[model samples]
Target: MFSLIVGLVVAVVLIVLNIVLSKLSFPKEGRILAILVILVGYIYWGFEPFAHHEMHPHVEHASYSFDGKQDIEALEHAGKDATEIKAFWATIAKIAEHKGDAVAGKALVTANCTGCHSIKSEGFPEIMSDADAAASYGVTPPDLSIAGKVYDKNYLIAFISNPVKAMHIEHKYPVGGEKVFPMPASDFMQPQEIADMVAYLSDAAQKVPAPTVKKGASEFEISKAVNKEVFETACVRCHAMNYAGIHAKTTAEVMSKYIGATPPDLSQYIRSRGEEYLHNFINDPQRKLSGTGMPRVGLTEKAESQVVEYMTQIGDSKKDEREALAPKVLIYLTILAVFALLWKQKIWRDLH
Candidate 1:
């Protein structure tokens, strides 16, 4: 309604401006150009409210809740020791090795996980594209083909059980605020079901070769390299960087179609979000903006720090050099101002 009023006012103002311009003593071409511009402006103003309404349609968010405290209590009751989570996973792995059913896991994956994630090069036959998925869910769901190797089995179990808890433990980063958009807990799944899935993932991991590590790089270089790898695996599907030749035209169109807004480029995200906020947001996006499309990437503390370092370097690589030159520039300006004042006084003395 406000947009409609503004649009109406703008249309009126354009009409008045057009009338005034028409009466001006200008050349025929100039007058025609002025009227055409006003017409275009009026048309845009008339349609802007409609476009605005379409872009931001009124919709109610469904009421959803998660009881983290209850979840923790349940874990405690089940003798799930946080310190021995890995040991628990080892036991599960041993059991799964003997009796876990890969066929059952495959059925579960097809029914639940296939909706958002794909294990193969060809993604699931969904209505939206990979870009759309990323726009909707913060990042595209990673291929599970190598996920078993990429993440620890213990962490995987915890994550599958309760993603929010796992993420909090891994990064210790807060969300935007109190509001959170946590992944739905798999509390519905039975222990046997989760174990079967784990078995499938572990077996899949064995089939794939391990990623080769590049050696001899400096710490900064290593951070950047890791950041690049992380970004490609997680972020590249959604957010694009100018340095990486990923830019507005491609991402903007896809994002606007899916999310109603384009995600900001990471090239200067550090400047906008800052280190602390970035850390917090990366850990849990819901803490900052509850309904935000950005999801927690679930990076470890070290990985999160590396990502921050990478963003900082890319965002303000010349910050140190710029700061170093500040004092010298100020001194030079001070000298110039003093000389200018002296010259002005000398020039005005004869006049006075």
Candidate 2:
């Protein structure tokens, strides 16, 4: 839980003490104590196997202009669809070069996407109901009302061009794999067409009210519902958390067909995977597990944090209690250590 910082700090202190002790002569009875300190320091930073460097996990993270740095989208370099990687990159470049016509995009949306989706704010209701859509496509299609606002624009552009490339799931594109993606790639549409649809969506989404900041509600409000909305919107489409009474719209079997395996219920993930891991994984699935069926979900930092907090609330109900008791437990241990040291000194005094 300390993330090895305490261990490293203790090692450093012992190393410094070791240097000072090396210059002094310890009493014969106390010589073993100095040796023990040196041995502990060696284990902390030394004693690596010959291939430790090679086998150690090289956990790397990729960033984008979304992180407020520059315009490098990490997923742009991920899975390619056959020999079309070059063309896909060029399409992305073209999409960036061109500005979309929102009005024209609205028409393109009517012609192309409204069969599965709905933009009620723009007077386009879903052609298929959730039940009907689920039966036909194995999962209900999401409303595009806020897609432009919530999703990363670059990701949206790439996803519209080719989902297989935007999401690193080329493994599922083979002959026997789940080749039936509900949202087909808009191969008939050029880069301009793709941008226009996104533009219409982006333009339309502005009409819908934005999601709450949620941090204040999670803290002072403590309603739990406010914090959980992020998880519901971002995660509930695919994964279920049965313990939290959150079920996926699609059945487990159908979800397996979509992603090669049914996504695991995220009930006990707070226990199995800590908050740090959840943050990284939620931000970008490929960052933690490359080629995962899960896409980047494209949540802001606040939304992502809310999901973690929701998970903590559901799965880690004891967190507050545990935190309150931690200091008392540490205090007891410190007192016991002090007593042990005094007893050791008393015995040594008698021996000397």
Candidate 3:
């Protein structure tokens, strides 16, 4: 709607300018070119809204399917040890130390998560297309290849056990008028199994090597490269960043249909949401907005800080350079203005 209004205003201004120019002594060729530009711009404005209609696709409210009995039965079949599971849950709740067996985690991941998520670079074929997955769950399940690297182990364990509960999201429809929680709680899996999954992810995905910065590169440039990698690996799956020139149109369309809205562009998100708000929200969005469709991506303390810094830098990349040159620019402009005033006075005095 904002884009439409801006396009209309631009088209109207161009039309008015063309009319005014027609009455002036502008060259025929220049007049024709200007008129043509205005016509083309107006034509584009007429179709601009439809061009991005996929960004705001209509969503229908649907019933969620949850079977507590079936989930309990599955948990029983998995040989859940109640005492061990309780202890593990308690440890995670208290943020206490607990050991996880990556070997056991690999087995658990194969048995449970492989159906929905792919871990390695290549091997398992995707069971569903992006559209199909979005239709089923509001968003495509992201690849888990680097999950361990991006997310904290404690958060990962808690999330895997009960995503909605861990994130403090309400288990209901219309969370922001069109949002839904599609990822089910893994309560069916024993707490030990959840820890094992986190263990495997930590071993396989955590601590992605930073991009090498060339010697004498600016801090902004190096930070940009690192953050670009982070966004591509984790964030580009859902959000679009126009400044970075990333757009996932098809994915956004399907997601809009399922989740009731496309994920917002992140180009100015840091500026709009502010650093503190983003920190808490990114840590756990459901905690901030109880029914928000945004999931916890499990960023660790360091990774989260880097992500925020990268976003802030990109959103206002020119700010530092602009501030550094402001005083010099003002001095130069003042001298230029003084010279122009003197020249004007000299010419007018001679005429008088």
Candidate 4:
């Protein structure tokens, strides 16, 4: 449009110059200049539609989002956005619908939280601190699990966006120390981003169990009980499913003695010892069952009993049954091998 106006103005100036020059008797040069200006204006007018702005036409489509919605309709579907970019638009759809965007929330967490607190292949705190809330970062990163139990969506967003609003006397840190650690104020986060992050955190937090209390003990019976309690309190941190396998290292000895390498069958111990003995072993494994990596579990007698009762009562898979099933597994593998060989050499390959 600007070019068109400029071309018109130039054409008018050329015409006026031509008239003036003709009156002054320089007709030939003036006519040439006027014709050039008119030609330029015609070219500009012909290309006027291209002057609006260089915008590629847009196309739209349907896609999925991490905000718990699927197959959201998309506007402006054109672009190299069909791959991972689709995830971003799906998040936009959720925000449009007033639902929270967890994928974007995860990005926010990676940007903000990963430096301090992280989960397996997820986000920060590369190594965890063994010390309690009395340690650094002032207050421990609250187990995101159950955060929503204590905090509402608005409360979480507000606290995360600017914790100073919630950082009054009762919530004040320092606990008698000189240093005061507080959540950093973020003008960096968008209001909707904060909302999405809070929503994501709330959902993530809900998947985790509540924090448990640990108590100390010394005797074997007490130690096993403590071990059980410790398993609940501390061991669960590294070992999921009562040390069945989660993060535990497999023993080559067990495999050499039996089949290859696998975790020892713990189902037998739980059944034979009747939970109490196992609890003691757990409480103080070094003292009671020396030369093992099992850490001492500081457990109160009541906590030990609770742990004992829990193990004995729980209907876990039986070791004997699993062992018995092993032969059947071997037989299935043998049959599969025979069939595969027959299929390859005798029939299927030739058919193909």
- Give the alpha carbon lDDT tens digit for every residue of 7-93 in model 1: 778778878887887788888889899888778766775567468566645322211112233334445877886444444444434
Give candidate 2's error at residue 131 in angstroms. Answer: 4.5
lDDT by residue (153-242, candidate 2, tens digit) is 777787787766566566656425646566787756877888888888889877875445556555523546656655766788787888
Error of 3 at 346 (Å): 24
Clashes of each: 6, 0, 4, 24
Model 1, backbone clash pairs (residues 3+ apart or across chains), number: 6
lDDT of 3 at 45: 52
Top-down TM-score ranking? 2, 3, 1, 4
Candidate achieving higher lDDT, 2 or 3: 2
- Tens-place lDDT digits, model 4, residues 1-352: 5655776786687678656756775568666776677677666655764443333222221111122122122223333334433454344344344567787887887677655555432334444553432144433344343343334453355456445322222123324544344457564666677767767776775555433334553333453443353343433332334343333222233223221223333434566654544654654443333344343333334444555554543323444467799999999999999999987877766787
For each candidate in turn, the TM-score is 0.44, 0.68, 0.58, 0.29
lDDT of 4: 0.47
- The Cα local distance difference test for each model comes to 0.61, 0.71, 0.68, 0.47
Q: Which candidate comes out best when scored by TM-score?
A: 2
Over 4 Å off, model 3: 1-91, 94-97, 122-129, 171-181, 207-219, 286-291, 326-352
Q: Give candidates' CA RMSD values in order.
A: 17.0, 6.6, 14.7, 31.3
Better of 1 and 2 by lDDT: 2
lDDT per residue for candidate 3 within 124-168, as digits (tens), equals 456787667656666667777777877667667767766754544
Superposed Cα deviation of residue 200, candidate 2 (Å): 3.4
What C-alpha lDDT does candidate 1 achieve relative to the native structure?
0.61
For model 1 the TM-score comes to: 0.44
